[model samples]
Target: MADEKIAKLVKRRSCMKSKLTVFGNYLHTLESCNELSSLQLLDLETRFNRFGSLYDDFDKLQCDIEMLSEEPDDEGEEREQFENQYYKLVAAARRLLGARPHQSSQLPDESVASCGDGRSGGFKSNCVRLPKINLPSFHGHYQNWLEFRDTYLSLIHLRSDIDNINKLHYLRASLKGSALLIIDNLDFKAENYEAAWNLLCSRYDNKRLLVNNHVHALFNVEHIKHESCSAIRHLIDVTNKNLRALSTLDQPTQYWDTLIIHMMAEKLDSVTHREWEEHRNTLNNPPSLEIFITFLSNKADLLETLQENKSKTKIHNKNSLDTIKNHYNQPTSTKYTQNTYLQYNTNKKHNNTYKKSLTCPMCNQNHFLFSCEAFRSLSIEERRQKAKDAKVCLNCLRPGHIETRCNLVPCKYCKKKHSTLLHMHEAETTVQPSLPVSNLDSFSSSTDVLDTTTPPIVLLSTALVRVVDSKGNVHTARVLLDNGSTANFVSEFLCES
Candidate 1:
């Protein structure tokens, strides 16, 4: 395992270092070449940093071809150099940007129109960077691959504002006539290819229709539905599709690791079958790795010998542990519980005194420290003590008194006590009977005779209102007002209003 890990690290390093070198060479070529314009240089550098150095050679060669094509009657020497540079650039592009085509369909026509409007930004515009193309000329940006990709997409959209159609035409013309456009990292959106492909297909008769292919179009998807490789159908011939995409590199590593771990665990299980209690009790301390491994190897040999012994036992009953002592050390049962621990014997008479004083009701474990159990799942003594402290009243089943003196019945007013009592005013038993109506003559005209005078009518008019309670029920009642009361009892509704 250690060797394998080392090998993997070394291989990863080698791949990265080689990538850096390839990019370094591409950068050198860009710097040494004198004929290229600075504006074009800036553009190439921007693209190089956005993608990777792998695309630099191809891009440079494309530049060289354009320069040569403009020369109507170029010198033989210059023409040869141009031809050589052109092929080199195409080869580099092919190497860096393999031919993985997009799989997803273009955005719907309505979506495209909406996005074309400034309001609904294009998918490319949403991105801040395009993933670096594998153009080895820009090695530094490779460290931040995702960021480079985001920035690249943003730049592409920004350039669309200047001369979108013309840029598209140039890219298409390059692909069709002289330049092989290698767009690597095909995992990007299909819209990117759609734009590039539209340009190429427009100039269909152009013999050098530069290829747009990937080594293998990856679908590293969160969900299978996002794998919209359907767009590839438009470009690739359906009958000969296998030629377009092929899996390279390797099968995923996780499957092998999982399989190895499971196999090791199964082997260990078969080789560690001693009775759990006996095995646990026998261990005075944690076994060293050497001791453990030796025990394992020995168990394996024993199991093999026991298999033979078992056949013999069918003919003659002689396969007991004692009978096979010389020939085998067969594993016993495999069950093991964490509570299995060693115990010491003490005199019953002395232990009895300790037991009476230390009986624990919670777990019914040992009576003293010396005789204590070692069950980890069971709470420690301190935790159990805290729990006992926090225990509820046994009779009331509330957090206070013991069963004998719980005092859980209703009070003198017949008000039942509760665990929580924010609405204690609603306690039914606390209500009192009304007083006798002896003072009514002071306020009323007469008990039997009717008084005709509208005499000093108090004219107390109050409002009744419906109130919504905490549980969302509406209740209605007339609120009273009295001048003689010590304090005003304002209804909650009136106060709120």
Candidate 2:
């Protein structure tokens, strides 16, 4: 790898100093002979073109020498001299050739766009610095080589003004993984740039490898499980990109339209596949790749349109409902409020009359059997007998129904089809017959021992709380408030829901 950096640093000055002497000789000949024959002009242009090929060996050899580590004392003068001759050589060729100029690296920086205003030779007024174009990166992937090659050639390698050092900097920066390692051992000298660049190109620029990579990519296109606008677009984009790459590889993808379509269609959702089949039947000629892609694009657009309209309809309905609710919920006029008050009182009076008519079967009290003090005072057996005699629900003590047909909840304690007050407690435990002292150990071995090491019983506070569900229906549920608990919890029924 070259010991390169991305800054505009001038390194390996001694190499250029040695090359300057040779470049100066050419300049001397051009300037010394003002007029030259066709042969002489040809020689000058040919030499200029040759030097521009960037095949110099001196930069590599000279940079490795310890003596050339620092530039010569007259490095400034030498560089200035080189720059002057560089432009002079270009001018001399152009002046002699009259109309045709021999191109070398690039034309003397004249044709290159500058960030400065011509008059000031500085940055132009009102200029906005645009973000630099990010170089395409490569990581030894055969599929990514062509893109990186084209981009690097256009931006760095082919540019004449950027020195070999800067080109090496850019090449190194753009590479990663195995690609970077190939050129990573080279020194950061101007001459090593070409060698590093060549190593990367030779390794990655394999036509056969690139073809295989893209072919595999095409075969591995993701399968869409369900039809949606974005899913269809993704399927279409991936198919086209891979096919385009394969076409560039001379795979005859154009002639393989039917085969390609069949392969790609299998990756589509069932609905889209059926649609493509039905649509292709209407075509007069055999279905082509372009036609298939166009069909998918159109379907994607239709799905998008449908989704947008659906969203708009839902929004409109929601707004209309909100507007109607607002109008109804607005404050009523005084007369309307008076009428509402009278209606509420009338409903209250009607409810009181209904309750007054519920005469208790026991003691003829003006209350339901369950609410009556006399009825509650009865023992469980008596209550059961009275409910049976009255033909009322044993679970709710309501008239005209049996406990089996009643919809009321069962007893909270015993979970039986009867009111909790009427549930008979289990018979008091009876002591087991005293085991013989000799058989105590045998008896203990036959029975499972109680787990004395069980977790301590925590005393948690609870309250009957009313909570509204997703449907806005209020439910009365008991909630435990335990400060020591790390998380809030709900019943299994709520969690599943």
Among all windows of 10 consecutive residues in model 1, the one with the lowest summed lDDT is 334-343
Q: Write the per-residue lDDT of candidate 2 for residues 92-113, one digit (tens) a residue.
A: 5445434223222322222233
| Model 1: residues with Cα > 4 Å off, grouped in runs | 38-43, 50-161, 164-497
lDDT, candidate 1, 1-497, per-residue tens: 64565455445534544554565577556556555554544444344444344445434544444344434354345435534654454444332322112112211111222112243322222223323332112222212222333343443424434254443333333232132343332224434655554443353322122112221111111221211123222112221231222111132322333342222223233224332224535878754333443444554466566767777887565445346553444343211111121111223333464445554334455442222343222333443343345453323323323444444453322344422111122223332332124433332332123212112332333445697767777777454443323344433443343
TM-score of each: 0.16, 0.43
Q: Compared to the true structure, candidate 2 yields what TM-score? A: 0.43
Quick one: best TM-score, which candidate? 2
